[model samples]
Target: MGLRTDPVIFSVSVALTVLFVGASIVFTAPVDALFGTMSAWIITNLGWFYILGVTTFLIFLVWICFSRYGRLRLGRDQDRPEYSRLTWFAMLFAAGIGTILMFWGVAEPISHFANPPQNNVEPQSVPAAQQAMGYTLYHFGLHTWTIFCLPALCFAYFVYRRGLPMRVSSIFHPFLGDRIHGPLGRAIDILAVLGTVFGVAVSLGLGTLQINSGLTALFGVEFSKPVQVLLIAVTTALATTSVALGLDRGIKRLSDLNIALAVGLLLFVLATGSTLYLVRGSIEMVGVYLNWLVPLAFWNDTFGDTGWQGDWTVFYWAWTITWAPFVGIFIARISRGRTIREFVLGVLGLPTAFTLVWFSVFGLSAFDIELNGPGGLVQTVVVEEDIPGALFAFLDNFPFASVVSAVSVLIVIIFFTTSADSAALVVDMLSSRTQEGTTPVRQRVFWAVTSGVVAATLITATGRSGLDALSEVVTVIGLPFFAMGFLMMVALLRSLNDDTVPEAVHHLPTLRVHLPRRRMPRIPRIPRPADGEPAPGSPRWIIPRPGGPGTERPGPERDHSE
Candidate 1:
């Protein structure tokens, strides 16, 4: 395989990334302060925009799913899904939010339970628990996936159907036309590359911390920067191997393993913990989430001025938006041959349902333990601020604690591997000139190593605070993409409307009336002599003309009676 790199996009993105990483290492305080201030301003001024923008994206995706465009496939009419449904869902889920779910499944809900967003709700009360579950579902549910769905749909439609290059700029083909090949397009792709690198780097950093915490819990390993950096190196090396193996052999297998392990872990928790309580709580949580989704989606803390929405809702929206490019492109790459409806519903529904259950299983179990059984989650998670350790602490209540904890650690590592490899692949696609065949293994390895370096550098430079600062940077970078999301919707809608219906879809059987066959009046046959002679006294033969029955034409006379 050729290198196939876009010189401008690759070089500029690499240089800027190196500069940012180097500056973060040298001027950590000032960079952090600047990002902190910018983050504060965004939350204060534009938090409403993030809320409304994400809500709009969700509405737009739903509308497109049910609209006339729903049947449009991401690829050609003859193309079918590249992977089985099970594997497809596994890859998307593993790449999209597997790491986030594992990291936050227990911590977010318990944090909310300990300190409810609203002042009216009492901490650790039933109301607080209900609100906690509702908010957690809101954060990880439809809105989160919708942010991913828009760009993925756009990229898939344009690249797979319209045959554009596989890059973020391809989404703008509807608006930019061939200008997508110019400097503007390069800039768009470069921005995507940067966002993806930092976004994945931040995730790697978070995963490293969680892994470190898990190690600390199990083997009493010291939770320090050196250990975390070493963890990043090891996981990054594994991710490099996966990406080098290419999509089907490397990423798909790892995603399958990740989901299997995750599901197994989830099942073990559900079977061992308060099964009945979790089931009932999960059902009730669904109800609560549905009832409050609208209000919660539109909630911007306008009147409350409590800043809770900024910290949780707006922050989550911005962070996920930053992830849209990496996750979106990766999703589009694997989502070929699927209908718009299947894409939207599957992307929006299944993972979300799984996330709710995952959260409920872990979250409710934590709640039950905190409320009825020996209570230590609140003290560990909320008071002590040991978010990463919360999962291990919660698992200690159940049997096979060490084994399950080890499984959880393995799950996190696999999740980290899948996410890093997927992001590296996507970053390579964004910066490259073409994605016709297998991507260059060296480029994928380079990105994988780059992501690890950034994560490790940030951790070593400023520790956990560096992760926080990087998150702020992501949110700030995500703002432009959030705005671009609106343009993408317009572009997608325009292209869909202008597109001709596929012949396969157009020829589908439809309701029609089959009337009884009408018998036509048969004209009397006249016999002619074999010698081409017109018999004497034979009238001119009349034949029916093009018009109905009455129209006739004169012909040579023939003898009917022999």
Candidate 2:
């Protein structure tokens, strides 16, 4: 079939993209200045909201795990899972983490070590290393994934179990009812489209810059806006091709390949670098992360001078919340026929465990080099301000830096491709009136190219400053959307209670009835007792009900006539 799309969603989304891009190009300086102010204001005023919102998402998901509603199936009770646990987990891990891990896994810990959150910990000391790991874990751990999990759980339950359209506003059905199809619903969806598009664009922009840096580090290619733009064009074409190929053939395959390459790269570093130190550091940091997670999550720099929390933690919350719709909807689309418990555990637990290990390996390698080996990464990153080159510089310490760097570039590019392609499909779904079938090739390519264009335009217009501004832009947009997430959690719980489960008798022992059958004395067609009266001549044999004791005693009961 041709590329079918919703006229309103497609037109509004396209017009907004054009206007933003054109204005950004024509008035670059003003746009940059405005976004900078907006970002600064958001961080200054609403940083607390972002922190508490993310923490609440984690707590809510964890509560759902132990709630009676956990056993509820996302789909009909009889429906079996569409994919096996391993495949499901792979998709979850791949889509959820994306290129952020590649970009930050090594650099984040080093950055944290260089600039410790609290002055109490000496910079670049053992204490700094522990605290750094805790910060990185805090950013990427269960809390962040909860942002993705909350909406995913909501969308999955509404679409798969309740037979609603798979859209952002659908999760608000309980709160909005038929109003989900009104102007308010459209507004919610439009925000989702903008959030996904701009969010993905920012990620693409950042990934391309990192890829460019890797290229320069490996092959001495000069980094330029034109080169980065060209990088976006080529990779976006690959993403367009993947979108054309559809999810099973394109996204799924690439995700599987990316996982393999990621694992291979991790193992290579583990084997060549200080393997023992990485392993030991991972264990110790996990302990520290757990110990500090509670206090750190609730901290808001209120009584202290921890502006760094706003910079890192609040920014992370904004980023994750902004990207939740795309990531969450994509997760919902793939995760069908799984129970609430299964979805929550897999979405919250599996990806987090993998992220911990992934960070442990790469993060500790950079830490080891900085502390024990010849130390230059902290100087390169903090002093020199060359963030993109951090990963390649860390890899240069080991043998075959060029080859591994090349592999890292490819992994990053693929991660970018998968993220862009998946995001395109999601945009199409959000804008489309129909939600059952695959998005059309033309629509997918349109969104795919539009995202690349925006990324390139933003980077070309404002450079890294513009990118930072865009980060705040999403944060500002994400606050209201984050409120909807709480509604989704409430809606999910309500729906779970109202909807019927197919396997209720199995999961819920209370639903199983075990009333004893009464044997009446072979009386054929005896007159039935009136309401509230026992069966004729069977009062002594009346069976007790399952829920509680029977109204009349089994042995005897006095009639009102007496």
Best-fitting candidate, scored by lDDT: 1
CA shift at 231, candidate 1, in angstroms? 0.3
- Candidate 2, residues 1-562, lDDT tens digits: the string is 4557767767888888788788877887787678768777888888888888888888888988878888888788898888778777767666777588998988899999999988888999988988888889989998989999999999898888778877898999998999988888888888899999999988988898899999999888989988898999988998999888998898888888998899899899989988888788778777887998998889987877668877888888878888999999999888888888889999988888888988989888888888789989998888988888888988899999899999999999999999999899889899887775375678888889989989988888877766776776787788788778777778877777666455665466555679999997885776777887877777556566776776654766768896
Candidate 1 overall Cα lDDT vs. reference?
Answer: 0.91
Cα lDDT tens digits for candidate 1, 178-265: 9999999999999999889999999999999899999999999999999998999999999999999999999999999989999999
For every candidate, C-alpha RMSD to the true structure in Å: 9.8, 11.1
lDDT per model, in order? 0.91, 0.85
Model 2: residues >4 Å from true position, as ranges?
Answer: 1-3, 500-562
lDDT of 1 at 271: 96
In candidate 1 the C-alpha lDDT for residue 82 amounts to 89
Q: What is the model-wide C-alpha lDDT for candidate 2? A: 0.85
Scored against the true structure, residue 242 in model 2 reaches a CA lDDT of: 87
